[model samples]
Target: MAEHPAYPVGLRLAGRRVVVLGGGQVAQRRLPALIAAGADIHLVSPQATPSVEAMADAGEIAWTRRPYEDGDLADAWYALIATSDQGANTAASAEAERHRVWCVRSDDADAATAWTPATGHSEGVTVAVLTTDARGRDPRHTAAIRDAVVEGLRDGTLVAPHHRTRTPGVALVGGGPGDPDLITVRGRRLLAEADVVIADRLGPRDLLAELPPHVEVIDAAKIPYGRYMAQEAINNALIEHAKQGKSVVRLKGGDPFVFGRGMEEAQALAEEGIACTVVPGISSSISVPGAAGIPVTHRGVAHEFTVVSGHVAPDDERSLVDWPSLARLTGTLVILMGVDKIGRIAETLVAHGKPADTPVALVQEGTTAAQRRVDATLATVAETVREQDVKPPAVIVVGEVVNVGVQSSPKTSE
Candidate 1:
């Protein structure tokens, strides 16, 4: 047990030497945090785990590829002794003590000059917990407390109403394909902090139901064709709400930049001098195909893949996609917002020399309980959609790669 209470201090180790004496699981678990702190990490180990080796290969740390020697901690500001050899750890700890560098011993907590508290980050705050009772140190209890605090802060359950710094800005967050759980941690936390959330019809709709009652949810569902005018209104709404000092979040489906016109909103905010944050979401172009058990690019089957927005027909004057070139490539083609124009797209592809028998898969409402997959070839896709009543918001994958993992998951097609 520690003789006295541990004095917790945040060390700014950026550009300072931090020596790690091992590359085992303990070192692997702790090195990432040190690296994130911008420490000049020097790792000394005879051999390392694959993950640790990868870090070395990536040049995040300098590995000596040898056991810890007496003078390894010569110029280190901080040292962590996690070697399997107790003798080596003891010697390294003594060397750190000589150098006046704080040392943490994974093998012996009581012998450690410093303790690594269970730490977690939420928003901009870091929560660290170290529990040392009369019995001894309880790492599990400390970790549990850290988790509870971080979770509370993330979900806004432990809000400090008066102490909170509410900065009004526009956050363009990606809600991910459909599942509320698929949204990123930062995206969800921003949602919990938002005062007004302008949402789309296609995103993780269930997340809106989880928001606090005070949050105003504006439906920014841009219906086909005519809703272009509504986009101006939505942009104005974002600008107006932000100018009024309200935390506004423009929650989009998939990634905001992926055909979601996220730049337009950002430019509007920039012109008005409002702060904007872009939180990328999991795009359905790649995710939807995988959720339906289809790999976008499979070995030997496909070496490349293309994501195309098919909202405009192939022959439309406004169409920017080169359909002839796309059909000529022997790779995967994933089309978004193309369910309505599937027939014309299929016809165009077949006419441009693509084989009619090339396998095609359509994933609808992906990554959700309502998700389903519809299978068809270029020749039959148009007819299949008609017979099955396939609707919008479906991803159309075209290529031989669609057949590779098609049988891995069961498809619920109505």
Candidate 2:
């Protein structure tokens, strides 16, 4: 018998019992939504994906650490049967039927009483698409449609009433390394809604071009580059624009707080009683290395990592970083703006205590199409830098962690 067309309605599952019968990809994909819905998720599975295991370890959800029992879903308001085993899915569905709980089957959507929809969210709206005969057709079409709608919503091409509230204020946005797609959902929305965007040279410049024509673009690079003078001018700009009832977005390359001068701008705004919000970006200190296949913090190999600016040389009075202490630590050393000073920095580290042959990976223009990776050791980093003609706006990683992720690194995977 064919199932009746399912009625679409939002479930009030907040703080309610929800039982999940698998820990595979399906469960992993659905768990984030369930967790966000405030459901008390009970995951039953003998094995789990690494990410799910980490979540369980973090106490984000309850893990049974075994196969589902007869009464696992007895009091569950909702049950998701998503194991790879056909028999297990059938068994869990039967149990859910007996318990009068709605079951969502991942393996066979038709076998279960409930169906999951292709969902997309932007701003404050969530779009869910459900086809009556989804199994008979290609799911890619539905996904494509969902993505198109979400993109339209994101770019402000498709406007929904009451979907977003635009309050004029300053948003310190970190555009994330270099990828235009890497900007946070909130950051993108804020950018689309921005009346004035003050962007840095290193930020995702492509995104600024996508903004509406009415939006004013301020080049932060044009600002005077004095320790106090540069920042003071930018602050005044944010306050003045926002005071004019214009939504100002102070867009930076990486994380606004990690040498991006975001908090300082926020402080400046607060002093003038202007409303400001901080939207964090993926910092190049960690992300740039990852783009070059290097994890800043690898398990067991690197217990910690330090990110420091190389904008100033070691001999400069303005430099406050303790090079000797940094060289002594047994973790990753990620240096930004160090291309010009790479030779000097390497000399100082080697002179202090760091190994002359320590593994180094310099990722230039990370996460972008122009990205390039140059590998070397402390003793030969300067030579490699010169050989590759590596330039500024690159990440220089110094440690064993660089060896763990890259294929050529001497270290083995954990």
Count of clashing residue pairs in every prediction: 0, 0
**What tens digits encode model 1's per-residue C-alpha lDDT throughout 117-189?**
9999986688988865624777888899999989878766667453666788999999899988888888988
Q: Which candidate is the best by TM-score?
A: 1
lDDT for each residue of candidate 2 in 45-81, tens digit (9 for 90 to 100): 9999998998799887899989877889988999989
The alpha-carbon deviation from the true structure for residue 93 of candidate 1, after best TM-score superposition, in angstroms, is 2.9
lDDT of each: 0.89, 0.87
Candidate 2's TM-score: 0.76
